[model samples]
Target: MAKPNALHTLAELAQNDTEAAARELGRLQGLRTQAENQLNQLTQYRHEYRERMQAVAAEGMTSGRWHDFSRFLDSLDHAIRQQTTALEKAEADLLAGRSRWQNNKRRVNSFDTLIARADAREEKVAARREQRTNDEYAARLARDNASRLN
Candidate 1:
């Protein structure tokens, strides 16, 4: 029946939807984890640099290790900014992925209405066939009785 075929098609769509959603979710989770890790690593880096600077000042090295530390600190700041930008981009990517997942869900849900419509139509056909068969049988019985009477 058409209902069975429709159900099979819907089942296939459901499987594809699930697989796509899982992949998207995984990508979003991974991005979030990476962003959080970077944030943690970037925090307090400057304070550590300052501590190294104070030690260098006390050690009285002819070489300007302090300058190098300051430059290193500046670089770390830039790296943090870059990381923040990357994190924002990742969040946007996650949002986009989520939107796609929602669209897939909607697509699958729409098929339910289609299947219901198909089911109603098939029922009408069945009812009409049954009615016609009953009428034909009644006519045949009436003819047989009339002939016997003759």
Candidate 2:
């Protein structure tokens, strides 16, 4: 009776754990994909910036315009540095996310173990109840036969 209810609660808890982990995995996958895309785009931007700088150097702007060209290059250099930092941060986050996913996977296995234990307990309770019923029926039958004989 109480055993069955406790088993039911354990089963429900296991189910809830599975559901929550799946949802979290889905969300993490989406974030991971987005981060990968951003990293690729940043890499491409860096390549294009290098080519543009090379083209500007080939054009060889005049000394009168040197300061302005230098300032522009400096600005692009700063932007590249900033993008590098962002890319590193994104990689770190991706690693951390994968670690978390693995940890959650391990946690879900514990829930499965709990579910198994609950199922085993329920089976024992059910077997005991079935045996009790059989005993009661046998007693009733013996009483009836004795009365009929009398």
lDDT of 2 by residue, 69-103 (tens): 56765776676677667666666766666666666
TM agreement with the true structure for every prediction:
0.69, 0.58
What's the distance in Å from true for residue 20, model 2? 6.9
Q: Which residue segments of model 1 deviate by more than 4 Å?
A: 1-18, 44-63, 135-150
lDDT for 5 in candidate 2 is 62
Q: Where is model 2 more than 4 Å wrong at Cα?
A: 1-46, 64-67, 139-150
Candidate that scores best on TM-score: 1
Once model 2 is optimally superposed onto the true structure by TM-score, how far is the C-alpha of residue 15 displaced, in angstroms?
7.5
lDDT of each: 0.80, 0.69
- What's the lDDT for residue 22 in model 2? 67
Candidate 1 lDDT by residue in tens digits, 1-150? 464695768757776986789698788979877996886688676667777788878978556666787788888888888888888888888888888888777777777667777888998999999999999999999999999999
